[model samples]
Target: MRLVSVDIDGIERPGAVVTGPDGVDRVLELRQFTGAGSLALLLADDVALDLTRTAIGRADHASLPRLADVRLAPPVRPQVILCLGYNYRGHVEGHHEGHVDGETGQDALPYPNVFVKTPNTIGGPHDRVVMPIAATDVDYEGEIAVVIGRTAQAVDESDAMSYVAGYTLFNDVSDRGWQDRSSQWALGKSVDGFGPLGPWIVTTDELPDLGGLQMEVEREGVVTVRASTDSMVYGVAFLVHYLSQIITLQPGDIISTGTPARSVQAQSAHLPLADGETVTIRVTGLGELTTTFVR
Candidate 1:
């Protein structure tokens, strides 16, 4: 099921997407039945997940609402949005952005470089991100984010995937100026509306081949970032298990895996987003997310 939350009468209601017989995609809203209007609430229940599967499997797609006409909200309003900074080899180590680096060099850091984004930063897939008054050099990082479905603490790497509910696209927007100002990443990473997430969540069952997932990011007709999860310095399960060692992960928590290196075009001619410009990120099975920038 393409787990999602749809807008109905200006309100967000949790839903699952089903393909109609005529080949059109439609929504199967779950809010009324589960009493869970948010993905955070809907995903916390095993019964809700099961009910969604049962209902969607038997749904009459022809009678369902078309997904195209519905407005989308951030799939989950996570209480804790944790992110990784340099988990992809191409992102650092002085190589071309997408080129894989050897185990030596900056990639040698065994520990994951993790950071936090304030809850205020999370915005909807189609939300217009307001330009911050204090900074002008804002850039974007396209990432694959995993949503936690179960509470986990001190979880092992072998059991980490079990805790993940689904996958979603995330834009880790940043202010370069502020980021260079300090060694710490919080100020640059925590700007309000810096994190744009979700068109919907693609539950793990939909795509069990996690390692081969490909990711791409485009800005102003140029491919700025392109790479696969196979190139990640730290894979999904390890990152989850790594984080669980420190803090308890609750259902609806988000952990954004780091962005790949910028494409050659980006490395040579990249520029901060201008007002009205848009960035679109697409991953193999998780779907695409397009974000517009506004002043």
Candidate 2:
């Protein structure tokens, strides 16, 4: 089932997208059922979601709201946003002059190169990605974001997938100049609204093999990034397990599994995002997320 955070009548509530009796998609508000303030609050409430899913399946059409009437939020307000750097072969070994070599001599890196972005970075799926004054060459890194369902520490790779609640789309907007200037990436990555995530979270039950999904990003009607989740140098299960060893993974914490190699820098013209241009990231099963850039 697809879970969404919705804004209706100035109140934010948790909802699920379900087809009604008319065979039309509608948003079923789960507030009455789950008694949760937000979707983020329900990540660990698996039993609540399971029951809600069953109820939604048999819910009356008259009781549901038209999907168009509700405004979508960022889906979840994550407590922490951990991002993987150079997990994709194409991104690590870019098709450019300054690309890094991906030959680690091993099948994968010893561990995932992880970085943290502040909570302020989160923005609604369709929200505008503000071009900060500190930024000049802002580019998009469209990725698949994993939401943790339960608290975990030192979880085994074999069981890490069980901790995942769902998947969502994320755009890791970066300032190329700032990113390259320092050895650390947080300065270039954590500007407010830099992380545009979600339209909704697709429960892992509906998408078991998360790595098999396809993802792509578009800018001004041109497809710029295209790749499959299977291309990650360190796949989802490994990253989660590795991260758990260092820090406890809590519900609503997001791990943005690395992005594929496609960005404005890859354009023949070498252009970064400009004001008024919109970037749309689409992960096959997870819904599309759009972010318009602004000054």
- Cα lDDT of all candidates, in order? 0.83, 0.80
Q: How far does residue 38 in candidate 2 sit from its true spot (Å)?
A: 2.1
Candidate 2, residues 1-295, lDDT tens digits: the string is: 8888887665678888987657777888888655758786677887787888887778777777887677888888888899987777766433421224565522355666678889999998657888987788888878889998889799999999998898888998887777666566677787889999888889888887576778888888788888887777887788789889989988888999877777555566658789899888888888788889998
Please provide, for model 1 over 112-165, each residue's C-alpha lDDT reduced to its tens digit, 9 standing for 90 to 100.
768888999999887888987787788888998899989989999999999899
The best candidate in terms of TM-score: 1
Backbone collisions counted per model = 0, 0
Candidate 1 clashes: the total is: 0
TM-score, candidate number 2: 0.91
Regions of model 2 farther than 4 Å from truth: 21-23, 93-108, 263-265
Give the TM-score of each candidate.
Answer: 0.93, 0.91
